[model samples]
Target: MRKNYLLGMALMASLSFYSCDKEVIYVQDGNGVESVADGAQIITLQVENGGDGLATRAGRPLYSAEAKQTIENVKLWICDNTGKVVYVKEISNWNTDGSTVYTTGGHGRQTTIELKDMDKLAAGSYKVYAVGYSNSSDYVLTDVTNVAEDGNFSENMVLSLSNTVGEEIFAGQMEFTVETGKGFKKPIVLNRQVAGAFAYVKDIPFMEGAKYLKLVASAQNQSLVLGNFNSVDLAGNGSGNDANVKYVVNGENGKSGSETYEISSIDLNEWFTAIKDENGDNLIDAGDNWKNPYSSEGHPTFQKGSAFGGEFVIPFAHVDGKQTLTLQLTNAGGNVLRSWKVNLRSSDEQLDQTITCWNSVSTDWSTEVTDESANIYSLVRNHLYGIGTRMNDDPGEGTDPEPNPSDPDDQPESLNNKQELVLKVNDNWEVIHGMELD
Candidate 1:
């Protein structure tokens, strides 16, 4: 037996800036008007995958793999012709798994949903909408019932870094006119609301016996704020000094040997200047680019506003072009072992390059033939400040200056200083010879 449930209460909800499709199809009666003898209507609420809702084939799934999830419930809304929400419904009960909920019969086996007390709906043009989600608690609810202005809806659907479930949100809307007697079968095609980027380490030989590697987003926080459906507006008041707000790759347990980390929400600013004026001189110099450990014998957190922190930085948000991500290899004792501060972007590029500085097959950094003409190691050594060595044409080449020249031995320059690392490459570039830090 089919049960008929009704929530006769009127729904007063807030409006959002998101728009819906304007075209509507009405199945007319002999009188050319829709008529529902019992003042009830049935609609097919389609549950499909949610990325860029493109079906590769005619009957393929709707969402892309990166944004696909099992949708558990849907929040439906009916708005008046004036763009005012008139009714709302929350539907959760369904028959099959979300992946198989949509079938070929045009009617869902056990997924039928109803809009009750249709007769109470005033005669006017209207639009119907549905939004589906898996985890309800992950999102901040927006009570838009009282706001009178247009739909600049609050960040009601923002997904945080902790929200492993609500990462995929889907919604669909259609416009239709409501008359005294009619409803027809309608389908809602849900679209996904997020974008993603990924990172990984390459050439393990240089990083042997290493147990930790972290990728830190200079200004981004652990939580990602989805301001717009497909856009991420990084949180925090641009106060990049907040330690807890900055997002760092927290690998499972402690370290991940070359595992890829997904960074979904990030804001890239070309002119981002960190407060590196260590001398209070109000100007940036090599002295300020040093990565400072939180405390003695502690791991270094890339300095708050330094230029580059030895981690791969991909400006996915920047339109100019893709930038290269640099890599640093360190020892178990927190000493800089090797720095491959080169233009290696993708893993394929890193693996295919002819440079023989560090390789996996050798399993030993020393075995790498630095004498190879194309070897990056030789190029790095060419810049070292030997007693009578001629400075390479590269003016950027030289010996690393002491980070704190006063206590040069105890506070040696960190590898985060590109110029210093290059100048002292022979010492800092190899674990067998580099000056180990305290």
Candidate 2:
């Protein structure tokens, strides 16, 4: 009896050890094994506006509409063709309001999970699942899609002006139209690039609370074409040098149009000269001398401010049901000088908005306004700069120049040197606006 009791205690100890060493697995089936295949590939998932799907057949990329809540904490994962887990990653949040929830990801809300190194992916159909957690909760929200061909289908387009740089200086205006085979929805005009591509959809006119339409971009006379798969930049070199170039529109449907214009470079030398002659003095001695106020970086200039203003016309074809249009600006340098955006609605109503960089440190850096036009709403922001009358006197007659008041405790007042103009268009085009420095 003593031997039997000792044996039973040994057996219990062994069972306890075994339980501690066992791995915990969560399985869809009531099996103890984790049923994940090795070397599986998972693709990125996309989120669409209005809870729509972003399949290519749907004609529009998936997107999340502008909402009051912020999206945050986007996590992505992948699986192989053989139903095995392969890879996982977390995405950085890109919203402005600091919300950690993610409304959309993976190819502008179309593909949720993008399979990495797809070239290495074996030729087979695979399934991808995406789980998104909102900023409000940790519950994993799931979205899934199928991956077939190892290539991308969507195309990207960009537009910009060479002469429009520095503070809000007027360049030109353009009108764009897009048509696709699939039905499109919930157009967005983005100021920044999406997924490594620039978008020109800003400060235009469109309908309010509409989901199916998006605007890519608008510029003086240039547009960019993008690759059908990756957002590779395409040249719109129509017929001219950099000083005066034209834009040519080409797409899968063979649509074509043109915009004519000239390029501009900034003339910093002229501005420096004007600043030195503030007191009507021609020399830069003593009181007239100022610190190096010129930029070593290149400035933006225009084609002699021609009296013959030009217009841009862009056309689209390949009408199926609905299509998404995108525009972008590339290789932008220096401070943005000025911009304008206008949108024309189907009801012949227009909406417009403009932004002018303000010189306030405490106040908002920009101002905005809205206006309406006939079938063409307009948004304009014209920024200007001027020298102030406050003068500075050199303390040593011809030595170190000091503030006119010469009080070491006094602070120099702020001044506006240059102006910039920017325009943006929301998905809703009902509001027209503009802004300027007072």
Candidate 3:
């Protein structure tokens, strides 16, 4: 009788649905509820009749089944213990067999969702909710489960150096080693994304002597490592190296030193140009001072008694632009070797100057300068005069040649017109045998 009544009602509704444009109303408790308008219908969702429940693991697949009736759009979401939605998926079509599987008409289908990287998901309980909506109504269903038994472990570690700029030391190649406890497996090297973050898959086997491991981080083309973790001794022994290994932090121990220099009154621009040696050849080349007209056979040679000294020329064009200039030096290991700051003062008149060092051979290792006026600078090594320059002169426009008592090729003492600035170690201005510029 119930079947007959349902069949009779379906027949009456189908017939009364008459005009294709006429809406089909649903009456509840004899109160006629407005029928859903054309293109309007409620969507409902629930676990599929024969579908399996949701299952997940750390490294396992995420599985879930859902049923949707022509109600509306269907969406599924997975949320963490904190109620934060971690995953969302949309279902567009849900159809099977000839008969509509969904309780609502026009909707029919069952679907299984898949998820990965479950191990990255935090260990805790989570919830999955399915929402269905159509023009007329909506439906929601939810399920909750514990994720602790997902069998995936977290393997993350943070690495840092006492020095803030340590990671930037070796042209960006920082190497480090890992140690796992005995019986623990070595973790899989995943990725090093941040300055101090490294991710690994827990997997390496930990041997007895693996209590501590040493790793050397080095830069390419460099002979020495930028940094090393030598005292990272593990406290426990384990079968597989877990990502949660504790590190025995220690103080940073490495090579350190410094360099210093003194500067006389000079134009800020000229002072900076004097030190700009971009090629790092240890000599001031033609390009060093764009306005200076001079060329050398090659990079300047710096050593005791070498004609090509390390003294550099100051261009007259740059003066009174700024005040103080400082140069910073770093060793191959990125350690601050030294920094020199020079105070610049306005000169009464453009004066010729000379800077001298007492010891010649030891200058290269100890003497280096940078132009704080500009970031222009260079390193002088093993040469008596690392840089030097003379006023640009026409090939043959100078006065009468010098009548030297010995060599005619040499200009006369009075007519020796070459105006050159010479930088020497421990030499005084009076001992300077160069011509005076007007």
Candidate 4:
């Protein structure tokens, strides 16, 4: 039951007409998709997810078990030379989806889906787009038009992860020609599209009186679009941290002057896959766990010591830019003692919202910067930067916990004090060891 699908095109995954409920469509010459050619070109496709999701080292070719499994659907597409999507299919539930057994690349016993429609297409240039994800309702494909028509790739394929938690998304694309018997042979390699983070604090002399310490990370922008610019926009729909944040303290008789105020910070627990712990997981005890580069994948497995540290995964962010995770020392009365902003940024590029970066040491936090690859100072996708810092130095400035992007009193600076941001990066579930503040 096939027909010419030359109708209006929308790039949404949940389009009623093009639902991802294991639907398949192809292009044919006649008005109606009836009698097909004798031998339609069918291409065998398999996927390979290199070394567990994240790496402890740069470009470390380690695969991840999270990527190995949890692939609920492989939404694959074939676009014409001009970016007009012609063929579409959702390969899922491989057990009965007419897929053959595939055990070569990543996890054993996957599937080898036979792709059609290439031969039906006239010989010319074409591209293959594939996105593998765990959930069907977590992503949105928007801000793209005309390309879905007969236009060029003038716009972006906005894969909005703004509202999504740390959901692991893998994408692969390739260009090829529809000529003779030749077809793509190499396995499509899917790479991680998010980053990982965690914090730890130790030896905070006043924490003995403050009782407990916690880490709060705030991102100025939520990665709205994906492209060369890595497009982003202000978080409005529930915000990057949502309108209401967790662990909030409305400055009631607050000891720390600035600490007693409305705080709008990204809830690490809500946005990230796993919030280190309800309080914090002491990362100092992370002996063997610290050894693994992609340890962020095993959130629950991390053993907590006496320090306030734990790990979670986040979207690809410019940590050195508008995103930062700060350490806060609070007394039992929910009063702030001293705060230190993980100085990763070189400038004051913050979100449009009213967020402060808190007071850092007299000397701002600076890192050995370079390209995104070597700059463990920034938060990039498919990479991990383990933050092993010791907050044993004197508390820098004001105690207001709510970070203001426009605040000039206590601004962002280079890494000062003995606070060395232990950002050791690697590749999937890329591991960024927790930090420790004394």
Candidate 5:
């Protein structure tokens, strides 16, 4: 059934007979109760969000899968030509019996709004503004007394991997002139003002005895102000050209092996574009502002060799097209040994795809066979970087063993006095043909 309501002059007298179910009331006329069109004019509005539901790169829903995230209520503000609000009305899922039922079914479907009472709309141009919430606690409506006195509306939409509950907010506006009898044609669609991101590091060589391994991005540790819906710096400051904005340290001790780190919380709209000052100012205008021109739709895919290095799917609320992201492999002391500057493609290809590190120098690692199915690309790189030799002997020349075993005397004669360069991945030693100590 079409939920209709009698608004304007009749609202005051009709409130005396309010019902607990919060159903719309019939507009009363001088003669008696009249049906819609028999007396009062009706204004219809349609509201919709972009798709069924926004989600993370891992395919997890951002809003409630059941569409319950959208609260069944909206607040409307009618303003005159001068932009001053004249009237305010809040239509909610209130029930006279105190048992409330709401518009809570449908995944990504448009909802409707109907307002009756053309009498309040004089013969002039007027503006109608509406705001709704996905969850009640996420936002609050205030002020809204009269045109001269308007209240402040607060908004809170938090997006993070850890956040499973939906907290989305939608808003729209329309302009219409009050005619003797006319209806609105166009509908309104609310735009989402936020984006999400997650990342994982794979096959990054951990520096041995280097304290700890840490993953650092060009933009990290930065907070974005939610009120500003449009800005190039929302993704981050181009400061990636100067200093790293964020860093996450691995809890495990640094050892020689292939490392993987996963993080699921990144706000694309949180702009941190200023060159971070030494004093660490949290204000948005505290430093030199350089806008980041990258869109949040894509993320960097890091690969040290043929294997995947790291995969990141970062989102942005604004900006468009391909974006550049830099991934760095840093030691606990803040030393970046290897970094990959990846240009993330615009589309689902950015999700669940592995990009090989184009700079990898392990041409022969693929041809070498190991006792176990392990990749020793990292081991070969470490050996060549240390010995100043481009190649090592075949597997028969020597044995590749773990360094500093419990019994030092049990070491092989061919391995004595030679620094052992070992590569480990998936808890197995990946012996390279030319990496054995001789």
Candidate 6:
């Protein structure tokens, strides 16, 4: 059963931004109007998904195996000019796990979300702030019921990064007007709100009696709030210095996960495989562009036809500075073999043949980077970064056993820089939406 979400219940909505037939569809009564419980005619918004919703498709990068467009619930706030939240409505459980299916001729799921409160307010201009999220519990609820014009709405209602990691945060804001008789009819396309960062572990040979590999992405905390803003992040607020938010991949055999702590990992042994050619050859491709991205002769490439490995992803709120990813290549006895500082902003043009570095991270995690072939320092919402690496026939170094994790003969090993692991983006990673932090 769908729970009652709206405290001051007024409207209901089901929207799909990218649709086929029509942008919006209204399945109304014979009178051509949805009658509300309070008899305040419904302001309808109809939408449907048109293919761009789920990003996981053929030839997509490994980390593309995530939910790009899945909005479970939405919280709406209709605020007046002075930021006074005059009306509030929460729509719960719209499209989830094929649970509710109101389709449009099988193109994609059709959605209809209705609005109320027009029967009370006078005709005027209003700002509609809508936030959609997958997990309801992650939202930091601030009562917008009686917010004052003295910036109370902006301070109270917000979404934080502490709990929303790897979760869906779809948000949108639109300005609309309400006439004397016509309630309110406007479309809200609540798109993804968090920037996507994913890491791929490839070309790492299953050698050296290696039992496990641990990968951790450490970033500054997302302490800012999503308060009546399109996105979060103060320009120079030092959010990039918090160094607390993290995404980890510790799965066995080079597997991956999407949790805050031990969210997911890779199975190292099962993660890597030699690229192949059409003539039943391994580590070779027909086009010659697929396999050898860096050098046609230096080392072999990873990711065969069927699958790839260590597809780790972290959904993050926009932080201020460059993020750090610490990779611990361990042996069977939990010995630290080697460390790597991944340059998430590794050149993407070699992958897409279009743009230079697009992310906006300053310093590399393990080793600081001065300049790059491509660099978009800041992480923005609705972007994707598919980052990967290549490990050659070198066994690098190793440390003593862990628990009391020791170094190689009490010797500390430096992290392998991104320039060493990744020379250029692979052709397989076609769409470079965004980049990892470091």
Which residue segments of model 6 deviate by more than 4 Å? 1-68, 96-110, 113-120, 136-152, 155-157, 161-165, 181-184, 201-203, 222-224, 227-264, 267-328, 331-336, 339-341, 344-376, 388-438
Q: Which ten residues in a row have the lowest lDDT in candidate 4?
A: 12-21
Among all windows of 10 consecutive residues in model 6, the one with the lowest summed lDDT is 9-18
Stronger candidate by lDDT (2 vs 4): 4
Over 4 Å off in model 4, which ranges? 1-69, 93-110, 116-120, 136-138, 141-155, 161-165, 200-213, 228-299, 304-324, 331-335, 338-376, 388-418, 429-438
lDDT of 4 at 314: 37
TM-score of candidate 2 to 2 decimals: 0.19
Residue 44, model 4: lDDT of 36
Quote the lDDT for 394 in model 1.
14
Model 6 lDDT tens row, 159-238 = 33333233334444656666666543344433333333333443342235554555444433332233222221111111
Q: Candidate 3, which ten residues in sequence have the lowest lDDT sum?
A: 1-10
- Score residue 204 of candidate 1 by CA lDDT: 24
Error of 1 at 64 (Å): 9.9
For residue 74, what is the lDDT in candidate 5?
A: 47
Clashes of each: 12, 88, 46, 52, 17, 35
RMSD of 5: 24.5
What's the true lDDT of residue 319 in model 1? Answer: 10
lDDT of 3: 0.18
lDDT (Cα, tens digit) per residue for candidate 2, span 347-403: 311122232212123333233323223212221111000011101111123332222
Q: What value of lDDT does candidate 6 attain over all alpha carbons? A: 0.31
TM-score for candidate 6: 0.48
lDDT of each residue in 1-438, candidate 4, tens digit only: 111110000000000000000111111111222343343444333432221123131121111112222345555566787777776666665323523334222222234344455425566787655554544434454432122434344322445443323444444455556655443332233344444343432222322344434545544223323222111111111111222211100001112322221112212222223323333432212222223222334331211221323322333233344324455556556566666544332221111222211112221212123322222133444433223321111112223222232333112212224343333222222222222222
TM-scores, one per candidate: 0.37, 0.19, 0.16, 0.48, 0.34, 0.48
